[model samples]
Target: MVIKLTQPPKEPKELGVEEFPRLGIIGGSGLYDPGIFENAVEVQIHTPYGLPSDNVIIGRVSGRVVAFLPRHGRGHKYPPHKIPYRANIYALYTLGVRSIIAVSAVGSLRPDYAPGDFVVPDQFVDMTKSREYTFYDGPRTCHISIGLEPFTQEIRKVLVEVASRYNRTHDGGCYICIEGPRFSTKAESRIWREVFGCDIIGMTLVPEINLARELGMCYGLIALVTDYDVLVPHQPVTAEAVEKMMTEKIDIIKRVIAEAVPRIPAEIPKCGDVLKYACV
Candidate 1:
């Protein structure tokens, strides 16, 4: 069922985030939380790509308008590779979400990045076998820049600053997106860390970030470290341990989002005019 909230106030010339139409929050595993919204309503959004992973929740947090969606449907129905990345991102774009905050649970690959630490990744390495990776494909083609600056740096900075106030947060790192319904094997994990030089590992965040870029939206990821991915053969990471750790750290994630939502800038030049000279 689709539910809609009352319209928020008009954008003021002051240019604060609260005046924006929507600030999107894409929740990853153990992070489909909307409790921070004081008066949230569930809204179903049908997109040209398809239905988003689940109903989007729109509400106000820290006096800012926020839209939250569970990448995996409630009860965790979709796997990482199966998530409707195109639909989810397109829906947010249609709903006027200029900026996106992606909250994902990930396995750390570095010794310094311990379990329960938070990382705002600045770059991404996509290692998925299948998933639609772009908004423009055939009739017309356009290339969006995801090379030097994959994720939006401005939003990353806001996430880092906000998280620093509440949790141990790494300001920058590289995220590796793997195709997974299952955890990585020791060899694969080691290759990702040693060869790929990825600091954290996850399944989603690939096409989602790309699609956001195609449509000229700012995207940033807040990766919560739940465990070490098979890199340390001696320290086995169990599903149970990951769930428990993520559950314990959920509060910190909420706090970070609450503080960061209001800080998104009113405008970004990187995202502006993205399609102006890209289509060919």
Candidate 2:
């Protein structure tokens, strides 16, 4: 069977009375609630890739137009590998969201980066397998260079500045994104920490950020530290413990985002123009 690919619209039509959001928020794990937004409204979007993780909640944050998507869906229905990442990102792109702030819980690999701290990662090592990582894979093709940095520096600067004001925040770190619904084995965790020097580990950052780059959208991650991965000798992590930490730090994530949103530049990132010279 052959499926048709939808050409991206030059500009998305306004949905109902809502203006298209220029900024997007993708909430992960226990961060699904869009209560941080004012005058929020649920928007059901159909993308060429498929349905988004959930109905996108479009609203205003600090007088900025923003759209929020719960990465795991409400009630935490989807696991990391099961997330419709391409669709989630494409939906946001179609809705005219040129910049995205991806928020997710992560396991810390470094002692200095303790649980409850926040990190704005500068680089990501993709350790994920079996996920669609791009939009230019078939009938059309483009080779976009991610180079040494994948996350948007402009977005990261705002997140770092805001997070530093009220919480423990790291300006930069390397995020090793693993494919998992399960925690890494102790040996696997050790290899990641000792051999690769990964500062944090998580399951969802792969195709989500990669695909954003493919579409020329500015993407940034605000990592919430939920546990010390099994690599830490005495700090064994559990689902309950991770949940507890996420609960405690979720507000901090919200605060950082609230402060960062209004400060993001209205223009899209300079690197987001991948199609102009990337395609042969």
- Once fitted onto the true fold, the runs of candidate 1 whose alpha carbons sit more than 4 angstroms away are 4-20
Residue-level lDDT tens digits of model 2 in 96-207 = 7889999989999888999989999998788888998888877777888886668888889999999999888999999999999888999888888889988999999988
Best by lDDT: 2
User: What local lDDT score does residue 149 receive in model 2, on the 0 to 100 scale?
Assistant: 68
Worst 10 residues of 1 by lDDT: 7-16
C-alpha root-mean-square deviation, candidate 1: 3.9
lDDT tens string, model 1, 176-207?
99888789998898899999999999888888
What TM-score, computed on C-alpha atoms, does each candidate reach? Answer: 0.91, 0.93
Global CA lDDT of candidate 1, please? 0.82
Question: What lDDT score belongs to each candidate, Candidate 1 first?
Answer: 0.82, 0.84
Q: Residue 77 of candidate 2: its Cα lDDT?
A: 86
Candidate 2: lDDT over CA atoms?
A: 0.84
